[model samples]
Target: MDTPLKNLAIIGAGAMGSGIAALFASKGLNIVLIDPMEGALERALKTIDRQLNVYAPGGVQEAMQRIQVSPGLEAACNSDLVIEAVPENLELKRGIFAKLDSLCPARTLFATNTSGLSINAIASAVVRRDRFVGTHFFTPADVIPLVEVVRNDDTSEDTVARVMATLRFAGKRPVLVRQDIPGFIANRIQHALAREAISLLEKGVASAEDIDEVVKWSLGIRLALSGPLEQRDMNGIDVHYAIASYLYKDLENRTEPSELLKSKVESGQIGAKNGQGFYTWSPERRERVLREKSAALGELAAWLNGKAGGS
Candidate 1:
């Protein structure tokens, strides 16, 4: 099984791809960043360097040397680990995995930097489903501390443990999720909140600004400390359960599945991912969002470390 990463490959040099590449390279690991074109890889390198410059302690320049930008897939095949950060399309991701499956050695760990997808389906194109795991990193991966290590039903204990160890070795909070589900872990909660957030906006219940304020400073803040389940237990499940029961019949039940969301997919408006959502984005705006999030994550990581007091 793949152990703590000695060398890593990041496929699809876009925002997430570059961020993941910067993450490993910043931690002193050799990273090969590959893209279908030289321009994509070049843009990814610029973004990665900018992020590392912001949060990277030694400045981005020093760490750029460890990052090998490759326009060719052949160079990436040498990695001990390959993280596919391609587009969210299943076929595209699976196609990349199939090539990686054939390009790399049997022992190399295969990971998808996907937020919400079926690992089994992705790995179906490859022979080793056990080695295939979800290594979901945040947008600015170099700075985010949380890395959800999702293990599917077919996954072995050793595979899960080794991936967890690798992330931990890179100073991440590698949270193990035993089951594979759509939007696993944080993203599930995010989608739940987002779905409702969209509902509130469409239903004229509140303005977008007000809704964000209420959640960001209230439920969103509290959720940072503990999840909904733990928070309910802390407050009282009976009371929480009662609230959910009422919500299911009232405000929550009143919510219609977003036509905008559906049409967006049909029309291809995949948020900042595709440059449109509830908000619109440009290349400049995308980088701005990433930079802001990365800085926040770096601060959060530092605070978490201090809170743990070096354990």
Candidate 2:
């Protein structure tokens, strides 16, 4: 039997890394959060404190105490599991893993929080390929419940099982990907929807506001309760099949990104960061929306947990 996970480490003190650390620490795991960049660790601690206040108010002090900030990978040499949550750069991640492979023991399992990078490619940097897996956590990791535990060709069943168990212990719902596909599961579907949404917007079929409203009021509510496949079953697979038979051809099938998105990037209208994209977001609006969204997500997560417990 595999040893139980206790000591965890997260490389990078960015938003995702800090969130992941806070999440595990809340569950009583000792986390060593490492970031070499000056002030990054401090920022991460503040972020983690805010998150723990929201997620584990009664135990904020205990949870905060569980996380130890560090400036180098050496501090994480003793960790049972080390998760790389750095930026989505293949070469950078590979270098980090190579260093970790040299410092850590053979028993230490490695995981990457890469959104869609090839698991096999990332694992190639280390000799313990069988112990490497992908633990793709969505943005706001502390709130999101779904985590894709991706298995590359070299990843062992034991590695996958242990990672899944660890994520479950931290209050996350882990799904085994089995295959190392680009974008994993949720991201691929999300991009497909974006393609269609952008295509419709470009064609003047509907205004951006209305298109977003339709998805928010309809699919958003429905998807929270039932996934796409389950909803298709509920609606009679034949009906969905019939719709797809015709609608499939009409849907966007562009192999590349939509021209509208490309043009926007060229024009420096890269959404919230720039104050404009599909919609204009002033600094105040961006701040307010993020704060509101975080609060709402926390409430929703609590409600979902309650529902899951009752069921």
Candidate 3:
């Protein structure tokens, strides 16, 4: 399939939307970022500018020039592809997809930036379900290299191929998720690890700090170089089997959210955005952590690129 991705309409100006716009714009794709809320477009532009300065200071202006913010969905009618990054509300997404289906051309591909939502249910709101697919980008989308390209039962092969190609062209490591299961692949694995972490905390197995340090220095580093399945093989499958046989029953198997997490949300200590969560976050500490994380991801990206080039 040829790359039919050029003009992109990003329909949301929140963090995820703006970050996505910056990522594509930096790769020379003209973007129309649409949001109806007052001052949203301006805030998104500022965010895009700030992020571009960090990622590509010399070419910030060039990238900014490629982004055109608008206050309505009509501005996206002429786009080749429309990526909806709206808040993760099923009704809101359905409404947006319904409108876009009526306004956009028949050839335009529709993709969602949902972290873990039903892609088929979202596509049901549109007539061209074959053209709709999930393009799940991680938080801080500009820095993350992984993009989960998800396809539902009705999604066409051509749509999957073209969407993957577009992501690759935009400098992303696209992984094909063959099914429309909730959480897809990455989030399933991620939340499993998170559940265990929280379980340990609740059981007084360790403090949050120690638990994070253990993962960050051990499984985290190893997983970065080799995935879980590969690492298991490297460690000897017999060892894994022996451990799982004894420990699987003891692991956190609750289907509901942990009480600790529920309480944190109920108290409005959501995370870095709210200045509190598992760790207390002062303004300075939050900024420092954000900077450190961005820098670390940048370094990892550079190392991965070098390795790929060498190979």
Candidate 4:
């Protein structure tokens, strides 16, 4: 079935929300991006314009024409798809969905851009529970291809299909998360790696710089080409099993956040956004890192799209 997602409404003007708006606009869909905070709409418009130039330069004018900025929920009343990209707080999300439920049409699909919140809990606040789902887009939503389309118990198969189809139409790769489990799929795997990485740092197994180098130079590249499961197959199940049997026991199985990480945050060294975390960052250094990262991601995405068989 063709996607029924022409009138899209994104109810936030932050990084993820703006990126999503730019992404939809680039795909020729009319978008209404809403946020009530002063100057937020302006920022979102600028962000959309900037991202469009980077990702869809040839169509920037046309895409910008299709995007409208709003500071009110009423603008989304006629939307076919309403994606809530507000803060990750459950109460905040529930309030927005409740308000949207009253304002939007019954047929409008409601999706949350929550990274790890329970889809079921969020859907409970709205009457159209079956229409509620989660579309967890990664940072730089316009560039990232993977979107987790999460479903709650009340969600219908038709809702899932429509969301997947809509994402595919918008030039995204959507994966269905059948259950509303915590950390759904990618995040669960990500945190597993993070826990171990942080634990390694805490134990002085390696310096933070060296640890990152290992990840970026080694694990990150190979994992992009083939997933862990596929790699296990290639390495022989028996061999992997033998290693995992012993390795898993030695791996970090901490239920709590790493003390080393807690200490960094406690001291206000909260990464590039600030000036320090694992590494110190000057404005120039941060900008360079961001520029280099964006370039690398763009290159990787292009290579994957063109020659990686849509990996």
lDDT of 2 by residue, 1-311 (tens): 33449999999999899989999999999999999998999999998898788768999999999999899899889999999999999999999999999999998999999999999999999999999999999878988888999988999988888988888888788999989999999999999999999999999999999999999999988788778998999999999989999999998999988889899999999998779989999999997887679879878877977986712
lDDT of 4 at 279: 91
In model 4, pairs of residues that clash are none
TM-score of 4: 0.97
**TM per prediction:** 0.88, 0.95, 0.97, 0.97
- lDDT for model 2 comes to 0.91
The 0-to-1 C-alpha lDDT of every candidate, in the order given, reads 0.80, 0.91, 0.91, 0.90
Query: Per-residue lDDT for 200-266 in model 1, tens only?
Result: 8878888877999999999877766676778888999889888878677655433456775678778
Q: RMSD per prediction, one decimal?
A: 2.9, 1.7, 1.3, 1.2
Over 4 Å off in model 3, which ranges? 2-4, 308-311
Greater TM-score among 1 and 4 belongs to 4
Candidate 3, residue 242: lDDT? 96
Give per-residue CA lDDT, model 3, range 1-311, as digits (tens).
Answer: 85748899999999899989999998899999999999999999998998888888898999999998899999999998899999999999999999999999999999999889999999999999999999999978989888999987789998888888888898888999989999999999999999999999999999999999999999988777788898889999999999999999999999999999899899998997888889889999888888779868977887977886612
User: What's the CA error at residue 254 for candidate 4, in Å?
Assistant: 0.8
Positional deviation of residue 139's Cα in model 2 after best superposition, in angstroms: 1.5
